[model samples]
Target: MLWPTNYTKLASATMFTLFFAGATFAPKRMVNGENIQHFLQRHYCNAYKYLASRLRHLDAVIGFEVMNEPHNGFIGLKDLKAYHPTETLGPR
Candidate 1:
């Protein structure tokens, strides 16, 4: 009694879809836009600082350029203030 590969894949997909159905219909609030922005900023800042501190004098490691790349998920939560977090609506 072994399931086919496609069957397993479909089953997994269906299960996840079901689990995330609420998110599809409404905001999940899994991530906050401002929090995520700050989190990424802190992440890169710390990494660069740590490396720069250790290897500042090294010629190859003259400078570390930190990129501030942020992503807004499906709900488009970049600016949630106007829409605001509530029982129904979320930032878009």
Candidate 2:
């Protein structure tokens, strides 16, 4: 199915927010009969595998790094409602 560019962008953004920003990946949290943490980890591993397979032949591509600047993912936060600022990289 073909999707409009704007729709695709919105969908991507929504998924990122839901999966990365919002997901706590707690063992108790269940989605579709699987633990959220395990589900996310499985998808991450699958994505890495797909990328590795596609880039394996490329000599220029030495390695792949996923989530280089990893966030805590809302874990062990004292305040759930408080806004925590992320450190900015690069110049303005």
Candidate 3:
């Protein structure tokens, strides 16, 4: 899973595109080889627990946002059983 020091040298110089080639070092726990649904569900559950426990005392606090400006992470047609690329990082 070790990449060359100069990963940018392989693709069009944009390392972001190259990251889709593998799932070795994922960002924000989002990788190519892992299960996208499980990863996002874990994040959501943890966030909900934290908010429900910590903010329960505050009456004004109804809910909390899981993430702000979240990225799509590493997803593609392989992760989802679809004819097109519909494995987006949302309620798909």
Query: Best-fitting candidate, measured by lDDT?
Result: 2
What would the TM-score be for candidate 2 when compared with the true structure?
0.56
- Candidates 1 and 2 compared: the better one by TM-score is 2
Ten-residue segment with the worst summed lDDT in candidate 1? 83-92
Across 1-92, the per-residue lDDT of candidate 2 in tens digits comes to 33322222334433443455444444466679876556767788999999999999999999977864343333444654552232212111
Q: What C-alpha lDDT, on a 0 to 100 scale, does residue 88 get in candidate 1?
A: 23
Where does model 1 exceed 4 Å of error?
Answer: 1-34, 65-92
Per-model TM values vs. the true structure: 0.33, 0.56, 0.34
C-alpha RMSD (angstroms) for model 1: 13.8
Clashing pairs in 3: none
> Each model's C-alpha lDDT?
0.41, 0.52, 0.43
Question: Which residue pairs show collisions in model 1?
Answer: none
- lDDT (Cα, tens digit) per residue for candidate 3, span 1-92: 23322322223222333233323433335445554445545566887897699879998987777554333333333443342222222321
Question: How many collisions between residues are there in candidate 2?
Answer: 0
Report how far residue 56 has shifted in candidate 3, in Å. Answer: 0.8
Model 3: lDDT of residue 53: 94
Query: Residue 10 deviation, candidate 1, in Å?
Result: 19
In model 3, the runs with Cα more than 4 Å from the true position are 1-40, 76-92
What is the Cα-based lDDT of residue 11 in candidate 1?
38
lDDT of 2: 0.52
